[model samples]
Target: MMACIQFLLLFCSFMYIFNVNPSCAQIPNSPIRSLVLPVTKDPATFQFLTTIYHGTSREPIRVVLDLGCPSLWLDCSSGRLSSSRRLIPSCSIQCAAAKPNNMSCAFSAAMPTRKRTACGLSTENSIARSATRGELVEDILTVESVDGSKAGPVTTVDHFLFSCAPRFLLNRLARGAQGMLGLGKSRIALPSQLASKFGLQRKFATCLSSSDGLILFGHEPGYDSIFGTEISRSLMYTPLVTSPDGSGSSQDYSINVKSIKINGKRLSLRQKGIGGGTKISTTVPYTTLESSIYSTFIKAYKESATNNYFLNMTVVAPVAPFGLCFSSKEVPSSMLLGPMVPVIDLVLQSEMVKWRVHGRNAMVPVLDEVMCLGFLDGGSKSKTSSSIVIGGFQLEDNLLEFNLGTSMLGFSSSLLTRHTSCSDYHTRMMQSTLKDS
Candidate 1:
């Protein structure tokens, strides 16, 4: 009995081990102060979202951390959630009916893009619209976080407002995230609501890599605490600007980029005479390059490679929607020989920041050898006045922080030296330690 007790004590010690993988670059001096889990990258779809546990029963629901969206939603039609209501249209008599007790009521969600047209008249004296059906529920939602008291603690939000989507045209990509957790500037969004409810600051950070990273809360215990003092001071920061058109769509993390360079050759994309027109953008799910900018970028890329290769080895005329296509066998492992792609630098006037999107993030791997540019074309002129929309692919290893308190968008190089995550390393140690004991 004494031996067994000793074994139990030894096993508990192993469970707390972290970053056991020596290959990891920089281990956080302390445990990370965030709720983090490995993301689900649908290899077939290139979706970098994760499913989370929510509701009273803690049912699993896949959600996207979308800054572009303004609310949290779940798919009830999937049959995963048991308590959900389908709302009736205002034009119908059921709309004036009394609220149901104990049961949550579903309603037509206001899709900003579609206002008045966002509803439907039910046939049984009511009609539910196509993409706007959902519910407003008050329940306890749980989130796992590091409380400084222990390694992991449950964050419960009582009477939280979220949606239940009964009908939202979910395709291969949209279906990847059954619900969307809005990180936008809107107060109704999850982050803002989470902060206001808990009296915590509205600052959050995400170190999202392909493997494992964390979504941290409360600025006090985040990067500043996790990173050593010297390392924290060296981080780069820029103002989180609003939409160029002053549309007040606070979702975009905008910055003024001066020019783009390849091998130090400024791509002649600078502002010409009196007025300038260069905007590089990165938004959630995509990083977009202006039409002319992308064309010039591709041309320069082709000239830089040996044998004047654009997307080398791969052949086939450029297809619709995509201009540059490459054969699977022909592409190099990285255009970036080091921290940057061979010699590409995106020069920004904000703080004279020269950000480099590593080759791994710049060129997305579609399949075996098939690769495509990670950026999309938002036409020569975007209706929103944004020339470029910075997307997810370009943010691979970087840790991005959107701090409302400081009104700054800060970023730093990958905390992990290599690709392996701390969580994976910890799990492996637990498994091995148990076996040896």
Candidate 2:
């Protein structure tokens, strides 16, 4: 009886222990809802780069943030391949997810002579305007998890699929950047994969600046404490539209712009210019508008600056990229929005929804004495599909939330108006995390 009792006691103890603290394999990982990537702008290239830890070694890999890219791709030759990496076979389900029409696998000329049944993915260098074939491979990826208020412990995603491109494809990318981190709406895009893994809402936010910035994957928490005002509350959203002609990737995000206004005065623009749609690009340094739209905008802006804000401002010689230049001595500065100039408003779906562009975003300083209009004349409508390509300069210091679930883009015009910059918020977040750690 004593032996049986002892056995029963042992069984009971085991059951209690199991219930209290399960084995490592049996314990399911807690879902990490949010992840953050530290973004930094490349001074020479004017491109934004974000860091992600990859492979067994957890090596930090910096990659360009491309909103239109279909998937994350890297120049495999640049970094040591992790032993845990797995090559995806051609015509496999994973390959189909990445490239729907991909049938036969053809190895790149730069690939090794050894024959392997690996999936071939097409990778592009948007800046260099080059395309090359890359092998699809999977490895572990790690990123810092956050809870809106503070940064948490590091979380990882095993078996993260990415392309292995040739070393030559790395040309024209930001210095030290190994590849591109695609945030497009494709199945294999970084944001989509992260959302799927964490069971998070299909949304992400980007706060871009000249220095360090932040990119949050998944639903963001309240920003009231950080920015003085709640970013979610102040965000103005507009429907994300796809181009009719579909010249670029179907996953590319675009918005419908109804009209443009300078200092509350509507600019006379052709309906065709407005109908072409406006696409967001991180690669483009400055905002580019169609020739007709540019002409109308420049004329109206010049008139506004001369008559309203800077009556004594002298028109200096036109800068290389910018057609309009003004003497900085005559241009007044503001505490809230850098230069005291006319506000440029982009009217969206309705008259009520407008993206107000402050002076800081409208003007760029080329020299100590000269400040020029930052906008570029993007040839004709035939040359480019997008009527207006909103570039990185205009997007800097802006808090933009791209919600893939609702197909809506929520934007906080400029963080400067809120008396906070992306760099400031990022620095604080990092410092807070360090202090807590």
Candidate 3:
């Protein structure tokens, strides 16, 4: 009788523990995950996300998340390194060579001696240059998710490999932050590495707001699932173009933009060279139209574009670099979005997926009332190049999904309005995040 009583008591305790802790449940079918991140304002407002890294270092290393580039390299100027970079037993024969270009382990110019040489790398997009040989080491990286998610971006990999550049001149990073996390098409890319370990597809979804945004893996969380989160609207997908040559560098996101329309007219993109399709970028946020394309667009918008957002302010004249300008005396500063602006839509295909860039998204306020067309002229053209580079500003407040398994890029528009001042937006987002915490 006593044995029977003890067994019943033990079973009841076991059931209670299981019910209280849902984390003890077995793994589910979903291999998907999400990484919620806070957006950065300056340099390129709402252009990039600060990636939080978890590694051997004492302090957390924050790196910029760049999807356009193919390699991961950090600015060691500020990084604290006990093991500068762990050298592979063999860098030559057994170790695989890096991509986009024939980037391999070689001696850096700064330290020419073979004995002193670790792996280093360098680039010259306008021209070809020598590779920088450096050391390859493994490290763990993580980012927090939104809605106070307990299970943030989880990695199945034992250890992820990343290149360490001891010293290098990266002008783009000069204006903002240090280091970069490349999520490009290369096999060495972070997404690919994560997929390899888990035997899952190389896919990710990113929702970009001017403030707090989130990134999801595998699939967008459905409300019923454990990784559930509500999405703004329906998703629109466009097929990605596999590079012209087998080389996948520049082609990770080069989508064929059949046509471009401004205010309802077909704007001509007379490429000086042979062929140039449109590509999307996370680094550059302003839409850069070629000189001829810009000319045609400016002519079209000039007739209808009005600056009524700040009538109380002084209506200053246009200045150099900018095609239009305005000023304010009574209003103090210009308004973000004018009363009414001309509709500028980018038609990718049929009416289904029109990347209708909000008027405010296409205009950058250089100074008070001084707004300029966010588009720029592609100084020189390449034979195998992109006609228009859709910058991040155009993608702000939108959810973008990159599915490598299907070779498709999905777009979903959000109804959220952006704040004129990034600082104000960031503060509000941080406060909201804190409240959730």
Which numbered prediction scores highest in lDDT against the true structure? Answer: 2
Cα error, candidate 1, residue 344 (Å): 2.7
Q: Cα lDDT of all candidates, in order?
A: 0.50, 0.80, 0.52
| lDDT against true structure, model 3 | 0.52
- Lowest lDDT sum, 10 consecutive residues, model 1, at 121-130
- For residues 190-267, what per-residue lDDT tens digits would candidate 2 score against the true structure? 987777666667788889998999888865453444444566577999999887776556767789988999989998
Q: 135-202 in candidate 3: lDDT tens per residue? A: 55555555443233333333323345566654453444524455666777766566665555444457
Reference-based lDDT, residue 80, model 2: 78
TM-score of each: 0.67, 0.88, 0.70
**lDDT of candidate 1 over 1-437, digit per residue (tens):** 65564444334322221112344323234433454333544444444566666666777777655554545666556645545233333222222121111111123343233322212311110001134545444445677655332235456555454555554434444344565565655544566656654555777766565554446666465445444344456667876665545642445456656677766677776542101223222224556576777777777765654334343343445544455655546444532222223356666654267666555666555556555555666556545556655665566556667787766777664433344333343344334445644
How much is 61 displaced in model 3, in angstroms?
A: 1.7
Best-to-worst ranking by lDDT: 2, 3, 1
Stretches > 4 Å off in candidate 1: 1-38, 80-135, 147-151, 172-176, 224-233, 271-286, 306-322, 325-341, 366-372, 413-437
lDDT of 2: 0.80
Tell me how far candidate 2 lies from the true structure as C-alpha RMSD in angstroms: 10.2
Question: 1 or 3: which has the higher TM-score?
Answer: 3
